[model samples]
Every structure is written in C-alpha cells, then in structure tokens.
Target: MKRLFAVMLIILLAGSMVFAGGKKESGTIKIAVAGPHSGDLASYGLPTVKAAEIMVEKINAEGGLLGRQVELVIEDDVCKPEVATNTAAKIVGEGVVAVIGHICSGATKAAMGIYNDSKILAISPSATNPALTQSGDYPNFFRTIASDDAQARIEVDFALDTLGLTKIAVLHDKGDYGKGLAEFAQKFLEADSRAEVVLFEGVTPGAVDYTAVINKIKNSGADGIIFGGYHPEASKIVSQMKKRAMDIPFISDDGVKDNTFIKVAGDYAEGVYASGPMDTTTNPLTIQATKEHQEKYGEDPGAFYLNAYAALQAVFNAIEVAGSTDYDAVTNALRTSYVETTLGKIKFDSKGDAEGVGFSMYQVQNGVYVELK
Candidate 1:
C-alpha cells in the first residue's frame, strides 16, 4: 500500500507538469496592432485594426501560424509620442510576439526603443521617417512603406521638373514626421539649382487659424508650397490659402494625401498636389484585400489600409517560415524571405524599407486623388 501511494503521487505530479506545459505551448500567439485608433487621426489607425481582424480571421481559417490561433493585442496611441510609450509598454506586458503599428512617425519613434529592448519585432505600415531604419539603432524594426526622404525626392522632383515651380515655400507642422519630411524637401530643393526654397518655416499644429502663415507664403513670392504635415493641418492651411485667393499650387507630402484631407477641406482640396505611395490597386492581392474589407466592413478601407494588411501578412509569414517566434529567427526570416503582399512580391532591405515600394505624385481633382501619370 505504501509503494502504491508513492507511485500515484509521482504520476499526479507528472500529469500536472504535462498539463501546464501543454497550456503554455498551446496558447494563442499574440500580435499587437498599435496606432491612433481614436482622436482626429482615427482614420489612419482603424483600418489597421480592421485589417488585423480580417487577417486574423483568414489566418485562423487557414490553420493559423504554427498550428496556434493568432490573436491581436490592439491598442491606440492617438498618434501622440507620450501615449505611444505607454502603449508600447502595454503591448510588451501583453506578451505579444510581434507588433504592426504606431502609424505616425513620432509615435513609432517613441515606441521603438521599448520594442528593441524587449526584442520584439515591429513592422510599420506608414512610419516613413528615414531615421527609423537608417539610424542603425533598431535592427528589429521594419516597414512596408517608403521613407520620407524618398517621398521628399518625389515631391521635389514633381515640383521642379513636372510642375515647373521654381520658388517654393517649405512649411511644416514642427512635429517629428512633418519636420523630417519638410527638412528633406528643403534639402532636395536647395540642392537643385533649378529651384529655390523661398521660405522654410514651421507652423504650430491645431492652430485655429493659419492666415498669418498664409500671408508669409504670399509675401515670400513662392510659386508653390510644400507643406509637410497630416491632413487636418493641411486642410486648414489649404482652406485658408484658398480663402485668401492664393492658389500658387499647394504641393505637400503623403501626410496630406489621405482622403480625409479632401473631405475636410472640401472644394479647397482641389488642385492640391501631394506625394504618396505608388498605387498598387491593379495588383490581384490588392483587389482581393479590398473586396474582403468592403464585404466585411461595409466601406472602403482607409489610409494605409493595404500597407497595414501587408505588414501583418509579412509578420505572420516570417513566423511561419522561421517555425518559431524567437525574435532573431522571425526577423531573419523577414529579411531573407520574400512575401507576396498587397504591394506585390517584396521583401525588406537592410535598412528596413520595403523593396519596390515608392512614391507617386497625385492631384486632388474632382474631389478624388488622381495619380499623376
């Protein structure tokens, strides 16, 4: 009887150990989706959340990664740097294997150190600041979008060569993203002898009125303007410019390329030139993604929707290919493997920028952004 009791105790201990191990190993894999899911920039972040949901559904239906159901740890930073740090900490605490957001550059930059220290891989769909990848500080960071320098080149070239604008005013919202792109534009314009930067200035964002800055641009005799900021300020500046009867070609960066800019600025949005990612709507993957989004969400996907979808797709693919969620393993797979995304067949370069992704010029015509041919 003593021997039998001892044997039973040993078996019970082994069973408990096995059950605990199984519970740990069989739990769902968590991927975080962080961005501005509320506030004025909600248009930029909610699409990513929806994309993750759709991707999670599709991935689970297709057996998920590593035979584990994929889960999303969605958090909103509202595109604020202070909020992004807290969001990053929350995501880390949540035990996510990877991250897919912090859509704005300032927010992404703020969160990157935390993710780097935690050894979690992050892929941004629209954090276009060049330093995020080029600075050599965050090896675990990758992105599905072109950087601001590249977009700046596109905007500068379009202004100089295409639009034949010589004297240009370069204005920014003084935030990290806006200032970074504006600086790049200023550099490019200064380098080219064909054009001159008539004015380089920063405006406080969320200001109720910008007529004072508009008057500055008018007084500078700028033939065109390169406004580096998002849609809200862009809409306000452009509306004020139009109200003052100043046309002079309001050229800006991808920050102003979103549809919300048009919706907010209304008729003033017309003729505004902005540079954004090259249109990949012709790709079959893009078509399918759009269809899925429309069917499920009852509306067109918002800004950076496909890019966010592609970011999540790349993360999942890397995990599957590495066959483990180890930080180095997944990041290695991401660098070495090619994943077919809405952007088409692509992979990350050493600098974490996506291969084959680039910017294109667009003009707001007939209340829609028409890609310039």
Candidate 2:
C-alpha cells in the first residue's frame, strides 16, 4: 500500500509541473510604448502611442506570434528626460520584450543608459538628433525616420538652390533635437555653399511672448529664416513675425509638420515651408489604418503615427524571426533582418541604426500641408 501511494504522489507532482510550464509558455508578450501622453508636446507623443496601439491590434488580430497575444503597456514620460528615464526603468521592470518611445531626442538620450543596461531594444519613431545614433553605447537603439543631418541637408539644398537664398537666419529652442539640427543646418549652409547665417539665436520653448526674437530676425537683413523646434514655439514666433511685418520666408524641419501648428498659428502658418518624412496619408495602407483610427478614437492621426507604426512593425517582425522573447535573440534578429513596413523596407546597420533615408518638403497652402514636388 505504501509503495502504491508513493508512485501516485510522484505522478501527480510531475503533472502539476507540466501544467505550470505550459501556463508560463502561453503568457502574453508585452511591449512597452512610452511617450508624452500629456504635456506641451502631447500632440506628437500621443499620436505615437496611438500608432503603436494600432500596430499591436493588427498584429494580435492576425493571429498573435508564437500563439500568444501581444500586449502594449503605455507610460507617459511627459516629454521630459528625467521622466523618460524613470518610465523606461519601470517598463523594463515589467519584463517587456522591447520599448517604443521617448519621441524627443533629449528624452531618448536620457533613457538610453537604462535601456542599454537592461538589454531591451528601444526603437524611436520621431527622435532625430544625429547624436542619438552616433553614440556607440546605444546598440539597442533604432529609428524609422531619417536623421536631422539628412533633413538639414535637404532643407539647405532647397533654400540655396531652389529658393536661391544666400543670406539666412537660424533659430532653435536649445533642446537636443532643436539645437542639434540648428547647428547642423548652420554649418552645412555656411560651409557647403555660399549661403550665410546672418543671425543665430536661441529661444525658450513654451514661451508666451516672442516679439523681441521676431524683431531681431527682422532686423538681421536675412532673406530666409529657418526654425528648429516644434509647432508651438514655431507658430508663436511666426505669428509674431507677421504681426511685426517681418516678411522673410520661413522654413523649418519635421518638428513643425502637424495640424496643431496650423491650428495654433491660424492663417499665420501660411507660406511656411517645412521638410520631413513623406506623409503617411499618401500611402494606401496608412490611409486605411488612419481612417480606422479616427473611427475608433474620433480624431485624425498626427504626423508621427506612420513612423511609430513602422517602428512597432519592426519590433514584432524581430520577435517573429527570433521565435522567442529572449532579449539577445530579438536583438540579433533586429540587427540582421529587414522588415517591410508602411514606411518602407527597414533594415538596421551594424550599429543598430536605419540605413540612409531622406525627407520631403511641404508647404502650407490654404490651411493644408501640400507636398512640394
């Protein structure tokens, strides 16, 4: 009787262990999506979060990977560096396979160390500071959009060759993304061509008043003005420029490519030229996805949505290729494989950065951003 009882106990214990292992294997794959869901730059960050959510939904509905549904855990970093670092740590603690976020360059830089130490991949959709990818320590970092250097070159060429402008003024908000692009533009314009920066200045972001800065640009004798910042301050400065009767042609980078700029600046946004990645609305898949997004959320997708969507696609593709949630496998797959996304085919180079991509120029016409041929 004792021998028979011992045999039954061993069998029961073995069966319970098998059940527990199966339950663990069937657990959901978690991906963290961090951005400024609330704050001054929420216009850019919220869309990124929404785009990631859309990608997760699509992936899950199409039969989730490895027979486990994917889940997105969102955290708001408020577009601040300190908050970004803490949010990244919290996401890592949650055991997510990867993170997609820190839309601003400064915030991304802040969270880089945390992500590096944790061995999780962080793919940003909108952070464009050239220095972010230039650093050798951030092996897990990736971006879908072109860098500021590429966009700056495009803008500089357009200003000098297309517009035939030789004298220009450059301004930035002193943030990593803003100042980095501005400095690049200044150097490229001055050294690469006859174009000169007649004035270089910095402005505090979220400032309520910019009349003095506008006046300074107006008096600098510059034929063109290039701004490196987001829509809020850009709109304010442009509005002040018009109010002060400074009619110099205004140009900017991708940071200003959103409807919020037009809404905030109103008609003052007219005639402004900006360059960024191609608009997703121009793509059929992106258009369809955006329509569904509006139907569900009751709002149009923002500028960074497509790029964010692409980043998420890349992450999932990496996971599918890796065949497991193991960090090293996913990271290896991400570095070696190419992902076809709405943005185009994405492949990371040795440094875990995207290959060279360019930006398109757009002009505000009749309150809409019309792509310039």
TM-score of each model, paired residue for residue: 0.64, 0.63
Candidate 1: list runs displaced more than 4 Å: 1-25, 154-276, 360-373
Q: Which candidate number maximizes TM-score?
A: 1
lDDT of 1 by residue, 1-373 (tens): 9999999999999998897566536888999999999899999999999999999999999998899999889999999999999999999988789999879999999999999999998999999888999998999899998876998888888998888999999999999888988999999988899989999999998887998999999999999999888999999998888888888898888788999999999999999999887888799999999999999999999999999989988999999999988788899999989999999888888878888678879999999999997
Tens-place lDDT digits, model 2, residues 1-373: 9999999999999998887556536888888888888978899898888887777788789988787898889999998998998998899877777888778899998998898898888898888877788767788888887776877788888899888898999999998888888888998987966788999999998777988887787788899988888998899888888888877788998899888998889999999999977655566666776786898799888868877887887888888999987788888888888877777676877665675335788999999888898
Candidate 2 ranges beyond 4 A from true positions: 1-26, 155-182, 186-276, 356-358, 361-373
Index of the highest-lDDT prediction? 1
What TM-score does candidate 1 reach? 0.64
In candidate 2, which residue pairs get closer than 3 Å at backbone N, Cα or C atoms, i.e. clash? none
Question: What are the Cα lDDT values of the candidates?
Answer: 0.91, 0.84
Q: Candidate 2: worst 10 consecutive residues by lDDT? A: 349-358
- Pairs that collide, model 1: none
